[model samples]
Target chain A: MKKVHILNYGLGNVFSLYNAIKYKHGNVNLLNKKQNFNDVEILFIPGVGSFNQAMNILNRDFKKLLIHLNSNKIKIVGICLGHHLLFTEGDEGGACSGLGLINGKIKLLKKRNSSDVLPNIGWREIKLKSPKLSIFKKYDKHKFYFCHSYFSKLKYSNQSVFSSSYCHNEFSCMVYDENIFGLQFHPEKSREIGLELINDIIRY
Target chain B: MIQRIIGRIDIKNEFVIKGINFEGLRKIGDPIEIAQKFYEYKLDEIFIYDAVASLYGRNSLFELIKKITKEIFIPVCLSGGIRSLKDIERALLSGADKVGLNSAIVKNPKLLKKASKVFGLSNIVATIEAKKKTDTYWEIYINNGRDQTGISLIDWINKVQDYGCGEIILSSIDRDGTLKGFDLDLINFVSKRSKINVPLILSGGCSNYNDIINLKKKHKSVSCAIASALHYNKINKKDFLKR
Candidate 1:
């Protein structure tokens, strides 16, 4: 069994992700500032807050440790605002530097029309960018729950594994670079399909 | 935009209950069990509202929300008795994706702004309980539709949005649990009068698939929350998913 750790940085819904992981994978734990990532195989950054608040906490506490983990090729998964924090910079709540693990910037999503809503809440179908990525074979055309105002603008297209469109504005819903993964949707809150995706990510 | 069919479970104590026009409560089933069933039915989301939380002054569904959210993977929203920032934090920490505010925001409208600032705008949902006051006016009600604030529905909608509420759940007190279908007139009036760009969720008086279809035909982008229809088996999950 691989050891999984969810960073409890007091921003997102860490408990939902923890519960989802612990339901299937027994070796999951919430990683707080005091906890060390000794034998952890996967570190999940659950998100439900502002990008600035999350980065403030991460930069203050786990910046060096995250760099260490990325350099060592340990799996790091970021969900929603957590995904936004993995970028180079974010414009939400004022411009701020991210972890810079991936070459991207987070910008507020532009409305295609006047009727288009912000924070893009609800389920949206994600299209797999490449058919060869077997890890996302089960989720190619399936819908995932999304709730965010800002989206990642990756510098490299190849880094995005899955892309989803909201109100005619296309954005990377899922991105992968080496051992790091970023998902703009909440899998823990997405039902069975989302749970299966989380399990696959853990096993991968 | 995908039309969401949210299953709303009203809880009074340990049991899930339903009422007509938000009155004459009747026990339905266990909240956890009903939530599980709703999840299995593949509803877009689940809304758990503590029916009497405001009457008692504090939300008592934190434990229930924690337990339900742990098992159910779909988005879960909890409302009722949420008076302060602490209540919002507790609801989020309990694993709820969104926290709905009503009575609290009515008293100190500033709480909505503070909550949106701290927890991000997307997680804060403003639930407006409206009662028809005249042919063209609707009054906002609080404390589970027991108190009228004299604030017009349109004015309240604009105020909440300006205060940074991410979403709005507009429920009709007159149509609630009547199973007479949604109050289309009320919905049309609000959508036209309010400058609501955020996702608006329509609640109350949905009896069958036609009601949902009618609502969709009129308002293509909005979502609907079904309580009495779903609880009484007048409409099932298949009915919602098929639409």
Candidate 2:
């Protein structure tokens, strides 16, 4: 059984992700402060609130601890705003610094045509560029529920597994560079396929 | 784009209840059980409304919503008597993914702006209960469809979107709980007139699969919320998915 630590930083609905892991029968714990990172086999950062507000709540010591945890070779999975937090910076709520776990910056999903709504709130299919990757093989060409206005634009590489093109722009939906993974969609809210993928990630 | 099938549960005093035309309420079962059942049926979303939250001057769906979110993995939308920013905070803390506002937003349209600013646009949903008044006009109703606000459906839609509501859930009070089918004319009229780019969810009077599919076909952007038809087992997931 993998030991999971879910960071509840007073932003977003952490319990949804908490229950998601619990539903998969994974051993999960909620880490609220900087000191609770011990024995964390899998570090999960889940978020759904404003980026600037979330960044404000993450204390300086905790930010340092995140880097320390990453250096310890702990597998980290970021969901939604959690995924945005891994970037070098974010423009939501008037620009804020992110955790800088990944080499990317967050930008608002540009409203291209009249049909594209801001905050892209609905289910969208992810076009997998690397279909052979075991971590995302099941979700290749499958739709996942997304509810965010901002997305990350990283330097494209073979490490980027999936992408969703919307509003005349494209953003990375699944980014994996070594042991770290970030998902822009809410797998817990995405029904069965999402749950299955989450289970596989936890066990992997 | 894939349209969603939303299972709506109306609760009165912690019991899941349903009524016709927003009257003659009858308890169906526990909200937790019904919500779990909806999840089992693979409904895309679950909408929970406290049918009489305003009448009692409080929100009674907090614990019910918390319990539902623990077991159900899908998004749960909570509405009814949501007045202040604190109410939105409490509901979100209690596990509601999105907070739906009705009487509260109607009373003070500014509430929409404030809530959206704090909770972000995507987390705030404005639920409009519109009753058909004439051939081309539908008036918005508040307080569980009992009180008429004399506000035109189009006007309310425009206002809420300006206030930054992420989604507009349009419930036809005239067709609610009737199992006759949605008011396609009303939906078509509103969808055409509205300038907002957010998703518009149509609710009330869903009887069969065709009704759901037809709404998707005619209006490519809207989602449908079903209650009576699904509660009574008149329509199932297979019926909606079958081409």
Candidate 3:
């Protein structure tokens, strides 16, 4: 009956994430600003929309909670905008400082000189770097759901940044370290694969 | 990729499912049984909606949902009674794979922000029950279509985009349960105007496979979430793979 707190950073799909996490016996807690989020091994900071609005809603110690969680070696996973915010800085609206756990930048989709559509949506593949990775436990080597207008430009060391190539170039799958991970695409709406990822992250 | 077949299970009073003809208040089928058989058919996703959750203000028949989602192997979307984030949390903890919120989003649009912020948009869907107004545009409704929010359908669609809902289930309350035909206006309206790039599920009034095929042909982005036709056996999903 361990608690898995979902950070309500003012954006992202919390219900589905809570649903997926709770299914795996991760006693899920929805942590908003006014609530207490203490001593949880697994923390999820999920968001949707653009980086500007997501950051706009951030206030006080809540925004930096991720850095604090990471320092404690707690397992953290960010989805879409939530994923991009872990980078050193985001270029979505302007130069905005992020949690900086992952070294990278967030870029908006440009219309010119690109054959791919905006939003970088639909089902795409994420090439796995290792079979031993915990997140890869119940998933295939590829195939995942994605929806985003911005992406990260950072690289990771111990973590694998699986790439989505449906667009002009390949983009990161947001996996890094043994502790932190991100998905430009949502694992919750990803159906089974998404659910599996959530379960694995909770176990980690 | 194996195309997943998702069944939309809309419930009311823990009995009659959505799109059920009350004039004919004859029970279409036991909902939990319908849910079981649909799982037996190997559906990829199951959407359980409590149509009366909003109007009745009762808890999301999670006790019933606990029965279905726990037994089934696939994902289940529990919609209907989700008025607050706490309701969404309650439904999720009850074993819903996804939580579908309608009505309240019309009243307090910011609810989507709070829900999506915690859940993620991919898990967040706005169920828009649209009907064709006589003036050649669609009108949005709430509370199981009992109250008219008077929000322009197009404006509301855009509004959800900003609200950060990752998907839109554009249902035609007018066409729901009526097997005569599906509402083409609601389908076409969303397909034309949506900019959010989220999955827009078209529910209501699916009489035959032709209605589905016709929809897929015209709107390549939308997916069909069926109810009535499947319940009466007028249309079997086995034929879905044929197209």
Candidate 4:
């Protein structure tokens, strides 16, 4: 079994991700200030706040550790705001630099019309762009819970495993670049399908 | 966008309870058990509101949320007694996806702006417990609908959006637990009057499948939160996804 570690900075709901992993894997640990990634097989960046705020924390605390993890080829998963952080920059909460693991920039989701709401909340379906990818082969057109005002724009379209449409704006909902994976939706909060997806990621 | 069916579990002293117009409470079951059942039913979301948290001046739902989110893998929105940023932080750390504010925001409107900035707008939900004041107007209520704030429903709805709340849970005090069907007039009135661009979660007075269907037919973009109907199994969970 792979050892899973969830980054627990003073932002977002870390416990939900921890509990989700512990429920199935039972070998999850929260990577806090005193922790090191020496034994971590999988590192999860669980976040639910503004990109600039989260980026500031990551830049201050985990920059070197993240570089080390990336170079070591350790599997890294980013959820929601954490997914936004995988890009080169984000416009949320003013412009800020990200981890730059993937080539992209995060921008506010444009409204298609007056009726479209900001911070698109609730469940929506994802269209699998790379259905041949093993992790997402069975999840085409599956609805996952999404709650964010911003969306990711990747430089390389091939990095996006799944794309979803919201407010008439098509954005990457799931992306994978080598060992780094990013999900704009909260899989931990997406019920059975989400749980199965998490398990699949862990197994992969 | 899909019309979501949310299970609303009203908690009073750690026990899931239901009532008419937010009064005459009757205990239903444990919060954990009720939340687990909702998750099993594959409801789009779970709303856990501590009925007495604001009146008592402390939130007791944190521990309950910790236990519920441990196994339930669905989004959980918690309300009642969220007064400060610290309270919001504690709720999120305990595994809540969103924190709903009612009485606290009524006391300090700026807190909504501050909380939304610190926690991100989507993580903050504004809960409006409303009662019909006139044929065309509704008034906002707080402290479990026991106290009234002079703020009009439409005005507050607009202001809440401006203040940066991502979603609104509009509960009708007259229709809550009545099983009479949703306050269609109230929903229509607000929809027409308020400049609301956020996702609205309509609560109260959903008795059967027809009520939900009717609401969905009329309002294509909104979601509904069911309490009495779901708690008593008046409607099948499968029916929620139908249509």
Candidate 5:
């Protein structure tokens, strides 16, 4: 049985994702120590806060451990802020640097036109391009839950495997290349359909 | 214009619907059943929110959503237990037309921006949770009203709008389920502070038609929201429809 490791940068919500994944994926562990990665075949970074703060903590506390682990070629999934931090540069407030996993600079939502709405909150549908995506391996036909203000027009090594559209742009939902993965939404909280996505990730 | 009739649901867990005013009203009545019923009545929309969504790290009521969304023809807005992009995506996949996020937006203002980009402006409804301060200002509270951010009612609305909420659901926690009357001062403060004019639905303090009437007059024909009064049947929809 493979165990999954969730990064605990003190942003809270670690247990929720843990419970969700555990409920579905079987074996799960709260990543308190970087050495925990030795056993974790998959890693998860889940949160709801400033990306700068979340990454800073990881760098300051884990430092050498994360750099070493990235080279292991094991799968690492970044969610929300976790996804943004994977980028090389984030334009939030200033040029706040990130984990430098992807190439694009993260920035605020493009301001909407007068008739166009802002803070596109709500259950919007993603026009997923990859029917073959492992996350959607088991399920299809529906929208995903969403709540965020900034997105990284990702500059990752691989192309965006899945996508969701808003205002006038189609943003990446799942991006992957080799071992690095980033999800713009929380699969843990997505219910059974969300669980199906998780099942795909674990099996992958 | 067909004014939106948004139903407010306060969930505790998978099955708990909290109504402080109507004792014994708390039970596991299927929210989907309620949402479907609203659709039958031609309600414009439905908002299923978690008053204590984050406290327990509750997942979206996907079971209920899976059922209701399949049946109901109208758009459904799921709130509560929503704090991030994942929560929003989960709600949408469960058949929600929109995600109503209250405290989550206040905590991570950036979430609005991220969600808007991913989903579009119409899909996200920013729920503003308020507690009356003095008589004029309604202080904003977050984390299920456990902590007072000390951000003024006016400032919170302005900032959240700047954050890019397509619509605002302004609910008064103190006045929730009371059926007294909608808080005009609170509604007024938010409306005046807002420059974008996204839809603002007033919740709490609705006991009769006059409250809506009073609120309308107070805001000079501006419409507002009333949940408990409608839920508990304190006022007839005919009265307002005729007005």
Candidate 6:
């Protein structure tokens, strides 16, 4: 079984993500400020809740820990709000600095037409641009559960950027740069298909 | 947009139960077993309402929810007795993705604003239980349809949206548990008048696949939540897979 560390910043659906990983028989550990990450192989950031509140509670220790992980080239995964927070800054609640792992900003979804709903909640498809990448090698067409108002707007497109879709308009759905990765959908909540993707990533 | 087929579970004292028009309650099955079955059958979401939580002054389903969350992977919404921000916090922390409010929000409307601000708009669901009063109007019922609020259903729908709720679950008290099909007239009225700009989940009735298909054909924007039809096996997994 793969061993992983999940950052528990006092919010988000950490329990669901924890259960999802554990259900796949992965040995999971919840990381807090006082915890050490010497045994951590993969760092999973599950998404939910407010961006500002999550940022406010990060404290100095967790901030340093994440920066240290980034410098060490440790494999990191961010989901939804967690994905957005990988950027340099976020605008949810108010303008706040992020972990600066990605070159972008978080913006709210704008309605192209009046019929579009905010906080787009439901199962939607994410067309993969990099199918050969280990994370998305299994499927051609993928549909995952999404419930968020804000998304990551990549500043530039590189080969590492894997997927994109139009909720209101085009937005980055998945990003992979070296040891860093991000998914804007809830894999843990996406049922069997999602679990397969998660298991693939963990095994890889 | 694909219309979601959701399973609605009403629980009292840990056992899943259902009642006609929200009265004459009786046991149905274990909440955990029913939830796991629904998950395996591929229900879009599961909504657990504690019908007697307020009367007891505590959300007794917290432990039950923690257990369910471990086995079920999809989103779950818990309702009943959520009167304050702390209650909403505890519910979300207890593993519910969304918290549904009815009598508490109807009594203290600002609770909607505070809860939305603290939990974010997407996490709050406003529940409206409506009963037909006349040929053209329905009255809003509270306390699980035991008391009528004398508030026009349309006006209350607008009010909850104005107060900043992200979604509305409009359950018709007249057709609940009857499985005759949804109250079409009531649903059409809300579909036409609601400018809330959130997903609308219509509950109560829904006996078969045709009822859901007809609802989708008529109201493309709304989703249906079935209880008795799903609980009694009136509708099967194949029916949902056909769509």
lDDT of each: 0.88, 0.83, 0.68, 0.89, 0.65, 0.81
What digit string (tens of lDDT, one per residue) describes model 3 on residues B4-84?
Answer: 345777666668554433123335567779887776654546777777778887765878876665545555777887888
The candidates' interface RMSDs, in order, read: 1.3, 1.9, 5.8, 1.1, 10.2, 1.8
Q: Point out the worst 10-residue segment of candidate 1 chain B by lDDT.
A: B234-243
As for candidate 1, its clashing pairs are none
lDDT of 2 by residue, B49-117 (tens): 988886677897877787899878888899998989888888887888999999988888899998887
TM-score for each of the candidates = 0.98, 0.93, 0.70, 0.97, 0.59, 0.93
- Chain A TM-score (model 2): 0.92
Model 1 CA lDDT for position B69: 83
Winner on TM-score between 1 and 3 is: 1
By DockQ, rank the candidates, best first.
4, 1, 2, 6, 3, 5
lDDT accuracy of residue B232 in candidate 5? 62
- DockQ of the candidate models in sequence: 0.73, 0.55, 0.14, 0.80, 0.04, 0.54
Task: For candidate 6, state the interface root-mean-square deviation in angstroms to 1 decimal.
Answer: 1.8
DockQ of 4: 0.80
Best candidate (score: lDDT): 4
lDDT of 5 by residue, B36-101 (tens): 545444444567776565666666586677666554444467877787887776766565657777
| Minimal lDDT window, size 10, model 6 chain A | A159-168
What TM-score does candidate 1 get on C-alpha atoms? 0.98
TM-score of 3: 0.70
TM-score of predicted structure 3, chain A: 0.86
Docking class of 1: medium
Clashes of each: 0, 0, 14, 0, 34, 0
Better of 3 and 5 by lDDT: 3
For candidate 1 chain A, the 10 contiguous residues with the lowest summed lDDT are A129-138
Candidate 4 segments whose C-alpha is farther than 4 A from its true place: B241-243
Model 1, span B95-116: residue lDDT tens: 8888999999999999999999
The model with the greater TM-score, 2 or 5, is 2
Alpha-carbon deviation at A71 in model 3, angstroms: 5.8
Ranking under lDDT, best-scoring first? Answer: 4, 1, 2, 6, 3, 5
